[model samples]
Target chain A: MVCELCAVAKKEVESELLYEDNEIMAVVHLKPAIPGQIIVFPKHHYPIFEQVPDKIIAKMFKIANKLGIALFESLNCHGTNLLINNGVAAGQTMAHFSLNLIPRKEKDGLKLQWEPKKASEEELQTAFLMINEKSKELHPDLFGREEKNEELVEERGRPKEIKLDKKKENYLLKSLKRLP
Target chain B: MPEEEYSEEERKAFEEKIKRMSPEELKEFQKRNCVFCQIIIGQIPAKKVYEDDHCLAVLEINPAAPGHILLLPKEHHAIMPQIPEEEIGHLFMAAKHLSHALLRGLKCGGINLFVANGAVAGQKFQHFVIHLIPRKESDGIKLELPQREIPEDILSKINEVVQNRFNELMGIKKELVKVETKEHAEKKKEAADEEESEKKKEETEKTDPQEEENEDEKSEESEEEKDGSISLDDIASVLNGGR
Candidate 1:
């Protein structure tokens, strides 16, 4: 199936391009969030943020910082915002992944606020404890007494499947089915 | 165009508040709503560029310019502050090279790097990403900010709540208990030796200690307290089944 970004990167669709290398492409947004807003994306289609490699992500940021500097110097904008929309819930429109770089001036009418919400002490502790526990599973090298065995590192990305004897499987299925 | 400026400290505090949400919350928030994951797994087609073991770079369908690119890690991370610190440098290094290419290739005046962390911050997608926007004279782009005033009491209350919660989560004010353990002593000795060597290297190379600390944070080891009894493990495990 044809993807819009794929078409642009492949030159199947005409675009006013800025830069292109073997692995990435930069283009001006047709309907930019702001006038000087630009969208930077990988040439290949990677629809989500979590699955992209670290090195490539680093490269993207390095480029972004440079662009940010350029915007400050050349465009005369006071600052910039590096924006990414990750999922449908976050208001991501395109199926493919992209970042929006928007130039900023003083009092330009964008309002990004973190209005505080009240939470009970119990709720606050629950939040803290959940992250505290999860951090152990996440960074064993830091919190846990034991190091992450080599076995775990080798199994980092791939999904794991559990094997059980038929009797055990049947028992498990029965128990789960009995849940109200 | 209007600029909304916050002190570095304020920005950090805001980021921390946003990141206070657990990873599970982010994961639940994503829930197969990711199109980028599909591309990585080769379920969907995209224009190919650079690919490595950890991340990928691609072009935007709706171009801000000719060479607009999006860089991201292969792993799905929705929040910016929650990303592993080590991975951050990698993303920026690639972006630096791309900026140079743009400078040489495009007829642009400058570039902008924009990131929105949450829905309130104009983040349309749940994925964590950075944008590179090129700018020129009379490009007509504007980022406007409207100022607001909060009552002193409300502001102080916000500060008290966030600060108190953050301290608890990070174990900032927990009194250090002296529990003499052989393991603790051995680790301390080893850490001292390592620090001595690191100091010597710093003397010779004049490397910034701050950068090193940032990198170490990614590995989850910190300089302050190596293995204290009042650690996250103790706090987290206690709540496991009780909640």
Candidate 2:
């Protein structure tokens, strides 16, 4: 079966390619939920989110963050949402995995919010126990590994230098710059 | 109770004060006002699920679904753009693992990994968080993002602007790469060169006659089965005592 996203990656489909590297690509969504919605995905076809390797997932999200910031700066959007629908039940339509970075505005008529459904204390506790137990089992290193001494040394040192260019500097300086 | 209203002059004074504050002072101020920071520091209580050096995951008090989790960075960051690349990578790695745990524990079909970066995007808090919402078929939670018909001219215009801005950001990243140690850069280049030669070897192997087609067909079939294993039909059947 031909994957639509793989076609997009190969430039077989008409997509506005926003960014590309060896492992990933970002494109303007052909049918955007919002005007500046961008879709970021791996160039290699991964059928689901869980199948992607850890390194590529990390790089994918890092690039997604950059693209989201681009939406903020270019479109003058009020905000952005990084959304992943991991499976069909979660509303994932395509077989290939991707992340949607949607530009948002106040009262934009996008209904992404859900009313809070209160679960009972007993149910909550049961979920907590089951999930916590399984999580610990799955990630033994995260739970059982001794705290590394290097982390403390790094924290005490001066923070990592994140050099911001002049444009970014202006954005950071104005607290309410994006706010109306 | 009467609502206390600030005069226009008072509001202007507050804005001016904020404008005059340095970035560090701004961060400190945001930290003080942030509730998630309090939760991270153990000043406020939370339903903690997982903790590591760089992040903390807690069960959402008001959840969209059972086993819904909020994954947060330990340090205070107001938005995604403010976070460094490495930290962003670490947080998502943790998120992936947490999603795996939810799928196994809750026996759910899927998970929604969501991040709202600003107030307009439903970011209720100042701190950064990734919401891991467990999902099953026909769960009442709705995330409706309706696709509207934008004019051709507008679409192309947006495409151009976003492309230019993304290029500018990439330029900034290139500058950051220049600061890496020479030794580290050399190591990366060496690794890339090795991988390129290995890829060339694989391409040569793929040119063989009948064996290549069979191998390709087998790999494709395996990939299909792997994808089909997580489909809703299979999960639904499992839920219906077919497991």
Candidate 3:
């Protein structure tokens, strides 16, 4: 229930804040790979990408684009690298979802190179057809109540009252009000 | 303009041609050929995790891990830089939701989001996509960041070059003179010679009736020369050279 990112969004935890809006926040990473490496995330506790609503995702990316442009312009870096570590296998350290906006310069010693496995034309076509066929049977009604309704049931199972520390509660309430 | 009328037989033949053609062949006819584009239009099927009018997220066929997803806009874009400004942010927003889905749906520990722009960045497919690679403990899929030590002088020179390129991309022309001088001072005192050549750019624009056409060619040339603009191979080569 008490997530680090939730705490940060609620102002329970102090972070190097860059930009914050009602839907999302951009903060400096504690251990930066580059000078201006930033982490942008949604204000609410959405651990992974799929749980958040489309509108919320759009807002987060809007912030990311702004942060990216600002990062390049203000920092004077050669280019920028925007990355997100989704699940644990992808080198995701934190459980909370966040996008890493890394400032890249020539010979900055920041390397994200990988040897690609070659796929034959046939193999590629096979994969393409499989994915294509499966896509047709997917959730046709975009942003339907199906997933959200399930989440509501999950929420109802949890304890109704959350006993927050008095100081933290006040801070969290203030932060909540501060949000548009 | 009125829509062209096709005879029923001709239309039937065209449909048959479409069925016979590979995706690449479809591209030659200026049809939607990219697999991801086809998915967007619902022509090709996908095990879609998320979809909205502006964007869509689908399960990757050869996933690096369980719940690995590919997020993209409904519109097709070959590379990140070429993506429309408005659609750029929405794709990642969708990815955020997909990441949450993987965490809860598959119960993965963490996640990694990767965007491979050109071929050098391991971008096999031409269509721009953000790969949502799920991370779990001991999954063994590595994202390596190998560091190398280089001499300070060379490092500074590299920095200057990269900075100049970035400045040019950002359209900060005022700093061009200062950047060129810094670059030339280190390599040699060839600063005056380059400056004279650089002055020709502005002069040509003023004198030429086909200035717009000339500018287009110059940009294309500069694009090839610009390190990490078209491909990151230039930067990679420099780093490798230093080692």
lDDT of each: 0.50, 0.74, 0.56
Error of 2 at A114 (Å): 1.1
In terms of TM-score, which candidate is stronger, 2 or 3?
A: 2
Candidate 1 local distance difference test against the native: 0.50
Candidate 2 docking: what grade?
Answer: acceptable
- Fraction of the true interface contacts (Cα pairs closer than 8 Å across chains) found in each model: 0.09, 0.69, 0.24
Clashes of each: 103, 0, 31
Best candidate per lDDT, number? 2
**Model 1, span A15-86: residue lDDT tens:** 545446677766555554444455678887865443345455655655554544444444445556776544
RMSDs, each prediction?
Answer: 26.4, 19.8, 15.7
TM-score to true structure, per model:
0.37, 0.70, 0.48
Best by DockQ: 2
What range of 10 consecutive residues in model 2 chain B has the weakest lDDT sum?
A: B234-243
Query: How would you encode candidate 2's per-residue C-alpha lDDT over A11-50 as one tens digit per residue?
Result: 8978777788899998888777777788899999876675
Candidate 3 CAPRI classification by DockQ: incorrect
